[model samples]
Target: MSNGKVYLIPNVIADGTQEQVIPAHVLSALSGIKHFLAEDVRTARRYFSSLKLFPSIEALQFEILNKDTDPNTLHSLLAPVFEGNDIGIISEAGCPGIADPGSLAVKFAHDHGIRVMPLVGPSSLLLALMGSGLNGQRFAFHGYLPIDKHEFSKVVRELEKESRKLNQTQIFIETPYRTDATLAALVQVLQGGTLLSVSSDLTSANEFILTSTVAKWKSQPRKLGKVPAVFSLLST
Candidate 1:
């Protein structure tokens, strides 16, 4: 039997409109796919409905691939594709395979010799880094920091040191509800001259992306509130 292809579908960063963040070709590709592996089934359904590209949501098959999903179940998820049915992988937000569980499915497709295609869309991390004025050529993406205050501080300092030593950019994100707390911790821990970038509510009307030194930020700090955001750092 002929194997099918796997498409990596990116999701919107914010809740405004789909057309603003998703590319036209991605929507066109989505219109033809009937199977999907998503980080959140409900969110995937909502995204599909927003596009109006698919024939019917009820007719599509969706498999959940969140943090709680077991690695053992990945084969079963790709069974349809092996049977000649093209499948799509969608995340809760942004592109899959970056701080998302959808990477597991992509890896499986690669191991099985299945073709995988990635579509263009909004990515808060990349957007933040692009506006950071930092070393985009050599950057690292550390999804989320340690939740413990002490551990988080240690990690923050280490990333700062590495950034300063190698002139490499360090990027990470925090849960929406804890954005303020994370920002406070970062501002207090990183060196005064360290450059920081914050991108929030990307692709939405209320979007904001700012880059400034830690000292300047302390003089006039802005609350991140509960909006989803991406943070990057570069030492000077």
Candidate 2:
């Protein structure tokens, strides 16, 4: 029997109108997918309802797949798909499998010979990089930095050095609560001429994306209370 395809769906990054961020094609895919592996089921329910993609939220099946999810259970998540049932994998925000636990399910699908389809949607990191005017040709996403101050500082310096030496854009994100501290660390740890880009509340009405040198950032620091943000670095 042929296996069903797995759709790696994308979600909106911030609290905003759905039509503004989610593509029509993504919604169409969601309309036909009744089973999902999501980072947060509650959020996924809310997202689907907000987008009006499905007829009945209560009828859909959802499985939680987060950082704490056991890798051993990933294969079982695809059992339905192997039974000729198409399934959707959703992230808490942005593209599934990028920085989310959805990667586990996607990997399992690949190993088991199931087809995988990625739908178009807003990715805060890529959106931030595009707006930041950073090196788009060559770049890397470091996910999250170490929370320990010393280690974080050391890694920040290394990323700066790589950006300087390779002309590669360095991208990373922090928890909303740690946004300000992360921003401060970037300015303090990077060289004066290193370019830093901070994009916050991307795709929302309050979206902000700025790129400046470490020296200028230090001179005119901006407050980024508690909000979703992406940070990028490029050394000139």
Identify the runs in model 2 with alpha carbons over 4 angstroms from their true place. Answer: none
What RMSD does each model have against the real structure?
A: 1.0, 1.1
Q: Write the per-residue lDDT of candidate 1 for residues 81-154, one digit (tens) a residue.
A: 98998999998999998888888888888888999999998888888888778898999999899999999999
lDDT of each: 0.89, 0.89
Candidate 1 ranges beyond 4 A from true positions: none
CA shift of 31, model 2, Å: 1.4
Which pairs clash in the backbone of model 1? none
Q: Candidate 2 residues 70-177, lDDT tens each?
A: 989887877789788999999989999888888888888888888999998888888998999999999999999999989999999898888888999999999999
